[model samples]
Target: MGRFGKLETDVHIKASASKFHEILHKRTHRISNVSTDKVHGVDLLEGEWGEVGSIICWRYFHDGKARVTKERIEAVDKQNNSITFTVIEGDLTEKYKSFKFNIQCIPKEKGSVIHWVLEYEKLHDEIPDSHSMLQFCVEMSKDIDAHLMEGSEEPYHNDISGQKCEALSINKSKKRHVWHCLIFLGLNQNTMGRFGKLETDVHIRASASKLHEIYHERTHHISNVSTDKVHGVDLLEGKWGEVGSIICWRYFQDGKARIAKEKIEAVDKENNLITFTVIEGDLMEKYKSFKFKMQFIPKEKGSVIHWVLEYEKLHDDIPDSHTMLQLCVDVAKDIDAHLMEGSEEP
Candidate 1:
């Protein structure tokens, strides 16, 4: 073998992490029932299912050819929701000297993100990279994600207009989905249209970089990000803090739980800023559109946080964005205090 290759991809899912991890490791053979189009059969050939050193054979079709892949269980880390396997036989052996695959399902507040990795050594330079195999794995991951999302309480991925979106019921039959997660935090206004900014700042004893790290990398640390007022934040389609990615905010507003999906319009790490543009939600009832922008500015000790709402009035008889701004301020302060308190601890 003279060639080596590795590839990694992330698949966003709104399913329970523990549940999906179970399906991936403990009940992998059941995938045939979930998606017959991809997985034909999975047979345990040797030691035991899911245990290290156990050999398993997969009978599947890839790139329009029937293929077999025999893999040995190498490691299973439950705490991290990860599993590893080494290919021992099958069509993969025809082109590779050795192949290792690692799958990790990372849990988020509202869903899970599966990180799939493949490391392989090819037998010759003529053998192409395992692009088709990676695509096969990604499709399989999506199938499992759809199956698990079926069990969530509120399918945040659905079009939560007061009227149930028929498309949802239709997809429910096909065992697939078209929508993803969305979130929103706004107040019902009694007056006409007005623009407002929710500005809140805190002086944490911790450093600026620490404040950013706690928020940027680990947003689940912010308590108010997921709660009664805001159902949850599901990353529908991108990196956590990257621009142009989409996110769904599940919300509990006015005696009802709804979803508002938005796109990440901007991300300025150097300035500690992230902006979300609301594309669809109950807020569409009274407003043409809305944008939520949160920024953290370095202060003397910690950071000065700012939450702004730039929105347009759908009509004239709607409420303003004050209460929503206040809510934003309260949430920001809560996060600041929570972080500050954590910083003072041993």
Candidate 2:
């Protein structure tokens, strides 16, 4: 006879112990056909899961044949988030006289760590080592961990009468048309367009590095070059692009150069969004303050750039910001045309 073999793995999940327990306790179908031979199938044999006496069965493929084994829960401890299952019957008896599997969860910051322990005893010294079985168990444990974590992605469901139920919805009357028109028209009260936009379809395909260089060179006069530019100044300069980074801009408007000072408000690389406050130098002095946000979203082969500007007018007759927004949209079209043209060249 040989000693019992063991295999273990520890993994962290981004969910509470209660949620994890609920997922594990729910009986579900197991793997049927896989590229590997260790796991042939899985089934809930007898009794409900999470109970001390519940039994789970595993059909394994070994030595070119399928073998079935059954395990009964020997212990259940909800407070400690642990469960112990002991092999009670099956073909496993031919190779291993006995087997036990234990799984425990330990609370961690904003998550929990799941530990799997498997112990088995060999029936004879001539039997092959349990390395393959141990490997199979570790992989299966990871799969279970993944399944449990996947449940967290779903919307919360209320459990009533031991069945999961979605929350009830309450309907309300829609707002009157008067309110909608007033809000939209009031915000866009301006009559004249002060900003002009020139859009061209020409391609100007440039690498991120090249674009960063141009942006930095254009806005270097400001305190920080990386956070102020359209493509992100940090690509050219080092990190540390934070709030208060001065952004400089000079654009020709009707043959006159318009200058503005911009202060970085926020940046999120993961989301590819940036916001800044603009202080118009030549014509923006009349406004209390102006703010704008730009977002870059990756698309199929290119990117969609969106710009939103918010400003409070100094005088009621100064006009609304809608015209300026239109001008910005035109400018974006021009930029996109240039980029597309550049991409087709090489």
Candidate 3:
């Protein structure tokens, strides 16, 4: 093979072409969760995500080796239903002088076809083409397709506008197919949707101890800081900051008021960590189980607030807890500002 060559492959997807294309470009960050086996994480390095010329870092596994790459979004053409990325640094640069990835979603009668193209120039003739990397991308596409199709309101159809959907592929058919697949895999449908663990880190100008105190000891006061999101919190059992304490929280999300009854599962003052497990309230209606862990790490200048969410959905139709993670970050930001203002007072 020549030092310069191209690798191409196509994937048949059950998801609509427009939706697949939109996800490939607009929701690139979410691919890591959808294809966790291949993609460990994606982080925005420069510019805004999903925009042309933005830079993103990818941590993935390829050929049984952990790999990392930083690529810049070179093109996003909605008219062609395609997006392109050019590798600027990281592992691939060691062997390849240049590497570029392009993905196009083509609408078809039955479903859609995802076409992946890899253009690269090897450093030397001895270096091999990156067929393995191309294969990895193909598998990731299938994972993304399955994720988009799961719990979607629209039936599988070629129309991008989503006005013309096939009635035969509606919710009933999708549910039956899912049940059949679970049966074949010897899995229980009721216990199967326990799917995601999401983590977020927010850096703030507040001290770790102060932040920890707010969540562990003075949680009821959070409504005063984040007035819009948190209406109030009441202690149901035990004392604040004590393990086994039960609390009820009234919050607003998705433009609606919601409530959650949570118990203090653990408290690690030494590490500035506290854990809460939801036992009752509105969240339980959609989730079989939900839990939250907050840890504050002290730094030279400020602190880092880390939030981890472990949740199990009642069914695949229930969305992942990305919004809840956003809520935690928002609350942290609000509290950080409140503490900074207090310190400035003479």
Candidate 4:
């Protein structure tokens, strides 16, 4: 018998189960709009959506390559908010004898839960379990959930993978480098915590250690700091740029001067992971809490730098972080441009 594996995952999101299932049944084609960077497009291949034996084709970028998948609707249970799709062609077929997805939505005390089950049989013993494939499912569920929740909100793109690389995606599912985040209020509104991860490819990049030094220690010395949305940064307490370090950022936001106090919680020199937790300042006044992290993953062409932010919103009207995130992205762009001009690292 061929090796078989199953992956079951449940995620909670603020949405309606019926609406969620309806999207799965009808709007499967729009996933590309929500996750434009990863899922390039999804097209109807044959038959009709929600009907048994219907076919759908997906075009996506994953792991630095473009890939495709064709699936057939094998089952549907309207009352249970459940549907199943069997992989009849494409990448999964190359190594797997057969694969399918069983999806269900269960209402919860608050919001709803998305339950996914993946059943697959490998063609050979050397084939591995569908761990990444499972992750792909989880990510897809989140994208769909986010899409439903975003109602009327502008579409957003979190970069996926490193530059020149995005994994195969479905209806706005997998991203190469970046991931979406839902701004959340206190625990009452966000029993499920939220965070955002952003990444950029640094051309003419510095080594991880070198990039870490500049990002952590010498950021205050940047000349374009003012133009990049940051006026200045000061080392408030502890050693600068080290674990347990404390720093204060003085910046402009919405035409107002703002300050944030953050402490370095963890640093991994070997893997180039850095974690910072926001402890106080104007940000704490507006946000429940915050954390920022940076990671430097090396690549053959250059390097990939990741900036991650975790924060709880004070209120629903506080406005999404789209502009703030754009500022961070702008800062990175300015830094790289300045570094190239100066012939320096950090």
**Per-model C-alpha lDDT, please?**
0.63, 0.49, 0.74, 0.65
Q: What are the TM-scores, per candidate, against the unseen true structure?
A: 0.45, 0.37, 0.51, 0.51
- Model 2, 104-213: lDDT tens digits are 77676656656666666666545544444544554454455555566544323322112211222222222110000000112221421222111111112233333322
lDDT of 4 at 59: 74
Model 2 alpha-carbon drift over 4 Å, by segment: 13-16, 28-41, 60-66, 148-346
Q: Encode model 1's per-residue lDDT on 1-346: one tens digit a residue.
A: 1166565555556676777777768777777767679877777767766788887777788999877777788999999999998987777777777788898888877566677778877766556556567668867876777776677432123221121111111011111111111111122223212332223233334456655564455554453533546556777787776777777777655567777788878877888777888998877777787888777767664555656677876764464454565456445555555656765411
For residues 249-291, write the lDDT of model 4, one tens digit per residue. Answer: 8787777988878888998877877887889888766667677
Better of 2 and 4 by lDDT: 4
- Total clashing pairs for each candidate: 8, 13, 0, 13
What's the residue-level lDDT of 280 in candidate 2? 47
Candidate 1 segments exceeding 4 Å error: 152-346
Q: How accurate locally is residue 210 in candidate 2, as Cα lDDT from 0 to 100? A: 30
Error of 2 at 171 (Å): 67
Error of 4 at 150 (Å): 20
Runs with alpha carbons beyond 4 Å of true place in candidate 4: 1-11, 14-19, 26-206, 223-226, 316-319
Which candidate leads the pack in TM-score?
4
RMSD, every candidate, angstroms: 19.6, 24.0, 18.4, 13.3
